[model samples]
Target: MTTVALVNTASIQERRDAGGMYHHRTNFDKYHPGYFGKVGMRHCHLKRNQSFCPTANLDKLWTLVSEQTRVNAAKDKTGAAPIIDVVLSGYYKVLGKGKLPEQPVTVKAKFFSRRAEEKIKGVGGAWVLVA
Candidate 1:
């Protein structure tokens, strides 16, 4: 079994600037505090903002997953909506706040996001931590 995670490029950068969180900020202007001597995070989204992440080529990572999983949602309906396994950098205060499903889903690959974990767990799905 395999899984897929989708993260917008801008979200990664947003997480780095918010002192490890992604909220209460607009842009990455000025040296963000608490980033001293530590390697700064990188942006995977093509655009510099989250609003444009959808247009970014997140396919780079998805393509690899498709090859390994043998489950291409693009071709098959059963495997189409691959459980949104991976977590993006930012959180959806409203969306993530919704109730989770109620079922056990054997996690195959890795995922990020505390909220996502909680959502998955609420639905009785397993949340396998990864780096």
Candidate 2:
């Protein structure tokens, strides 16, 4: 029995040139032409549309409300007690880290922590989540 083996006869130079040609056309580019898409543009738009609000703590809210409003509970010695409205319009979130106010206050904010809600309710204060 006789056996024969076939081998590729292409020269090394020709193989190298072919390899170079194969890699000449590539999908990747050093400087991509259309790199930034609609998503990237949308990111820019979101950055522009972003709104920032100041944060406040429980104690800060008490002081802020006291400063902004003119209603005094002390003034009413015989009549109905005044209702202190703490409209934290520009505040984004109210934290429950500080001391709770002795007097019940109506807090209107965008967001509040769980502890803040509990403290507010515990002190007979009302919390309103505003848009």
Predicted model with the maximum TM-score: 2
Clashing pairs for predicted structure model 2, backbone only = none
Model 2: how far is 49 from its true place, Å? 4.8
The positional error of residue 38 in candidate 1, measured at the CA in angstroms, is 28
Worst 10 residues of 2 by lDDT: 19-28
Stretches of candidate 2 off by over 4 Å are: 1-44, 48-53, 67-71, 74-89
Per-residue lDDT of candidate 2, residues 7-98 (tens digit): 66677556655532246324323444444345433333356425665678887765664543424643544544334334434568888987
User: How displaced is residue 112 in candidate 1, in Å?
Assistant: 1.9
* Residue-level lDDT tens digits of model 1 in 1-131: 78778879798986665643334332323446553456869767667554522211222223323453533434554423344333353322212334533433423333334665566566555545443
Candidate 1 C-alpha RMSD relative to the actual structure: 25.1
Evaluate model 1: give its TM-score. 0.24
- Give candidate 1 regions above 4 Å deviation: 1-100
